[model samples]
Target chain A: MDTAVLAGEIMQRSGAETYRVEDTMSHIMRKSHATRIETSAFTTMLLVSLQEEGRQPLTVVRRVHKRGMNLDRIVHVNEISRKLCGDSLSLEEAYAELKAIEQESQKLYRPITYQAATLLTVIGFAVFFGGTWLDIIGGGIVGAVLVGINLLGKKLRFNNVFQDISASIGIALMGIILKQYVFWNMNLETVIISGIMPLVPGIAITNAVRDTLMGDYLSGAARILEAFMQAAAVAVGIGVGIVIASALIGEKVLL
Target chain B: MILKIIGVFIAIVAYSVIIETPRRFLWLSGLVSAVGGAVFVVCNEAWRMDMVLASFWSALGIALLSHIFARAFRAPVTLFLVAGILPTVPGAGMYRTVYYLILGDASMSSFYLTQTLEVAGVIALAIFLMDSVSRIFLKRDVGTQPWTKERNMDKKQEEK
Candidate 1:
């Protein structure tokens, strides 16, 4: 039961779907000779109960306060549970594996590699949107600035909304500066859009759709609200950036 | 078109890294995302389909591929589905909605907002259909086993 709850907690906190969480917990519980297993998962909590024959019901509840997207952790937990269910792993081994996964999820990526990935994402989006070579260069520079802001925001532990807004404002300002002083014909719209791609809530929206479709109405609604808030933050960020850029440049770029 | 596909692959790979997808499955996720993007481009640009409908088809294709990969790799579908569907998501529409709203153009803002919601709804429907169909097939396959039925009966009794 403890192992089952631990697995469920890791999956839930890592932003796996609620149904998947329940399924994994119950599967793990079944391996313990439990006659009955009941598992319920929410966006913020996990409840699991295992009843063996004639004893008492063992219940465990874990409250998940912070949720982030870490699919690597989810896949790890899934694999561990599958092995446990197949009788390949002992209970203690499963526990140790889950603990390791928890730690791995907390580890941060290398700063340089993360920054490079951000740059590539921005440039890729710019090219995908039909931006020219200059747009790609402008987008890369803007993306680098955004990455710096994100690293700073992480160190400062800023709220997600504030982080997105500030990064976007930085991107817009950098785009304007590039257009005026560096590249005369750089497309600010493409640069700004590509820079903001990392901030968009694509995963949240997709998860919301899946949750709602799977009949997990509560989590589905919660995820939808989460996506909406994220999108609103990005929009507010870019809007503020655009306004500030226009004010500083003394030109109406909106028209 | 080739550049767009390559761009989609690169962008999805970067996104997979950001989300911390398992290293083994990163390339598969990127490939699935590239397929979705190609389908979207074909549907929206070549066929001139409406944006919402195009998003629906693209999302549908991604979900199907996700299921296939999930079964093949013994991993969860979300491993591929989340990153793969990024290309068809209404990120641009959401931005445009807010952009128009900031510009004080209510009509355009509402227009983009509706488009975003419609695309979201269609994506939901596509995933829902895939989930239901897969469940049905899985049930049929498992139903042929006597022990599986016995387990289901046991579960029903326990629930009662």
Candidate 2:
């Protein structure tokens, strides 16, 4: 029971889909002598109950917070559970493995590498959208600035919506500044779109679709709403930046 | 077109880093994403498909590839599926939806909003179909269903 709950907790906090979380937990619990196992996972909480013929029913509930994408951890937990079910690992060994996975999931990438990845992602998007060399350079500069803001925002523990809004505003403002003063022929649209790619909720939207199809209606709807709010925040930020820039320059920029 | 494929590969790899996908599988995931992007571009430009239809085809390819990779690597399908589907996600439409909304152009906003939802719907259908078909054919190996033979063995063991 404990092992199942632990696996579910790790998977939930790591942003596994709700059905997958329930499935994993149930799979782990089935290895025990429990005759009946029931597990249900929501976006914010997980519940597991197991019953044996002669023993008291066991129920565990875990509240999931701080959901983030960590596919590595999900894969690790899946492997550990599979091993446990296959009888290759004892209960203690499985528990220990889960603990190790929890720790490893908390490990952060090097700050420099993370920043560089952000820059590269923007450049890639600019090129994918058929931007010119100048646009790629401009997008990279904007991406670097956005990465700095994100790092700072994480340090300050800013609200997610607020952080997205501010970062997007920075992106749009930089794009306009580069177009007006730095690079005469740079395409502001390509640069701004590329810079904001990292802020988009692509994962959330994909997960939401999967969840709904898997019959987890509650989680699916919640994730869709979350994606909408995030996109709106970014749009508002870009609009604000464009409005401000246009006011300063006394020329309307059609966005 | 080749540059776009390369860009898709780099973008997916960079995203894998952010999502902390296992390092060993990063290259494979990038390849899957690039293939999806290539399909999307072909459907959109070469075949002159609608945006929503193009997204559907791309998502179908990605989900199918993810399932294949999952079976080969003995890993969860979500690892590759989430990253590979990035290119087909309606981020641009979402941006346009909100952009027109803020600009007070309700007609444009509504158009993009519908486009976004339609794209999301088609992507969902593609994934659903892949999952259902895989579950039917690979019922014994996939281990997604609870009533598989392995679970029955546990029940039998408990009975004894």
Candidate 3:
């Protein structure tokens, strides 16, 4: 098709702003046909396109800004001429749409809570280590508490990774105390699992393996590398604990 | 039975909450997890009953079920894997191997390597069998295979 028609089609399909419609079209034109677009403009346009394609947005966002000039001021004289002749979206509908958009964005931005994670991890460890049913159940309860505290910490805008690491260490100390003071042979597995459960990259490693087997060489390698890095992070935490415990107590105190 | 079911429930709840799935589909996921755990329980008992036959049958069963779940859920294969594979993941086995290393129990590195390979082989076999059945029966044709001219067109787009 001709350039103008292509521009119009891309604009309609992508929901590109009237002003940016021409620029994005030119960008697409300059790139090879095989090139996949990754620009923010293209991504926004693509999301809009998906909406136009009848896919309901699982989340939505709406933003209004004072750009220091009105649309009528910046718009073309001919566009103003058309606006005088025609009408468009109602203000109320725009506001409603924006509200939905904000809700969607909030959902996407929600971080994983550590409450349920820690409790479940501890319970898993207890049960797997053959702890009594009560001990196992107690571990689950602890995990729930950890998840709750984690969520609260996030809501309070606390440090992200630091909160996580501290909570994990806190849970570990609880386990150690219970073992040392309460149950002489208490299960450490529950504590360790609960504490480190969130950091395990099990799914990532599994997908990496599956992708490699299926010959998705590029995606596979990328995922596999990510899996190892996450694994290394978990290992480093363990190593650091061991090193610190060794120096302070002069014994293997990180049981 | 109920206790085992509870363990399975815990697994599913833990995975979903940990993975951040919404509450809507969690019940469905829980039921699926319970079923997965029960399957492993049977498989484990059977393996104890007869190692050779049970291993063959269990491997075959897991492959069939895995492919079915992958197609039905339209979820990534990893989800089914995390749920179903856990019962058989040999986490305890790995821990034992780790403990042996920490305690310096014999020249255990080679032994642990063998154990690791055994675990790897089982996983590899399960995946291969699942993929093959998927190709043969379902003919779902994942991977880079070109089933038709139109499908091949998609590859042409991706290759660039």
Candidate 4:
């Protein structure tokens, strides 16, 4: 029971789909010869109950928070569940592996690599969008500023919405400055769009649609709303930044 | 077009790193994204297809590849889908929608808004279609149905 709960919690926190979470938990519980196993996973809640022909039932309800994208954890947990279902892994071994995954949750790549990824993503998308050399250079600098702001946001413990907003505002300001002084012919649209690619909710939106298609309405609705909130935050931030920067520069450079 | 494809491949690989995908699978994920990017480019530029249709085809290719890679590598489909779907996500459309709204250009805002929603819907359709197709070809239902007595009996027989 503990193993199943831990596995579900790990998967949920790592941003597995609700159906996948429930399926994995049910599979894990079935190994114990539970006559009735019920596992239901919502966006923010996970519940697994098992009742045999015994005197009592076992139920675990874990309120999951702090969801993030960690595909490695999802793959690992899925593998563990498959092994457990195949009877190759004992319950204790599965539990221990899950605990290790949970404990090593903070084991992301180095901070420097994350910053480099942000930089490369912006530059690559800028080029993909058909930016010229000037646009690519300008996008690279904006990407650098974005990474700096992101690191600072982490240090200051900014909320997700605020972090996106600030990063976007910084992008807009940088784009305007580059257009005004540095890269005169640079495409502001291309640079800003590429810079904000890292902040967009592509994964969230996809997962939301998938969940809805899979008939998990609650999680789907919640995720769709979350994605909208994130998009709105980014839009509002860019609008405000463009307004502020254009006002400072004494012209209407962008909408 | 070649440059664009390379750029998209690099972008997708970097995105996989940010999302903490398993390092061992990054190259495969990038290849899937590159294939989608190539399809989109051919449809949009060479064939002069509508942007929405191009996005649909691109997403369809990515979803198909993701499902195949999942089966081949024994990994979750989300690993590839989450990273490979980046190129067609309509970020520029979403930006334009709100940008026009802020400028009080209600017509343009609504125009881009409709386009953005259309792209999103079509991407969803593509993923759904691929998912159903894969399920049809695979063994047994892979959904969240509870275990049945028949399945248990089969397992016991196999053990015997």
The order by descending TM-score is 4, 2, 1, 3
The digit string of per-residue lDDT tens for model 4 on A1-255 reads 898889888888888888888878877887777778898999999988889886599888899988888999998998898888768999999999999998984666887888899899999999899999998899899999999999999999999999999999999899989898888898988999999898888888788977887899999999999888888888888888888887899666763
Clashes of each: 0, 0, 12, 0
lDDT of 3 by residue, A127-169 (tens): 5334575466556655655666567776786553455545554
Candidates 2 and 4 compared by DockQ, better number: 4
Task: Specify the highest-lDDT model's number.
Answer: 4
* Alpha-carbon TM-score of each model against the true structure: 0.91, 0.93, 0.57, 0.95
Better of 1 and 4 by DockQ: 4
Superior candidate under TM-score, 1 versus 3: 1
Q: Write the per-residue lDDT of candidate 4 for residues B92-159, one digit (tens) a residue.
A: 98778867876789999999999988998898899889877886775353522224423764587569
Question: What lDDT does candidate 2 reach at residue A185?
Answer: 90
Error of 4 at B5 (Å): 0.2
Better of 1 and 4 by lDDT: 4
- For model 2, how does the per-residue alpha-carbon lDDT over A1-255 read when each residue is reduced to its tens digit? 888999999999888988888888888887777779999999899999989998999888888888888887888888888778778999999999898787763454676777888888888888887889999999889998899899889999999999999998898888888898889799877788888888887788778877887889999999989887887788888888877877787565554
Please give the DockQ score of every candidate, comma-separated. Answer: 0.53, 0.62, 0.15, 0.64
Model 3 residue A67 distance off true place after TM-score fit, in angstroms: 32
What's the true lDDT of residue A88 in model 1? 95
Classify candidate 1 by CAPRI docking class. Answer: medium
For candidate 1, write residues A1-255 as lDDT tens digits.
Answer: 878888999899888988788878877777677777899998988888888899988888788998888898888887788777657999999999888777763444665777788888888888877788999899889989988999999999998789888887788778877887899888777777888888888888878877887779999999999988888788888778778877887756665
- TM-score comparison, 3 vs 4, better candidate: 4
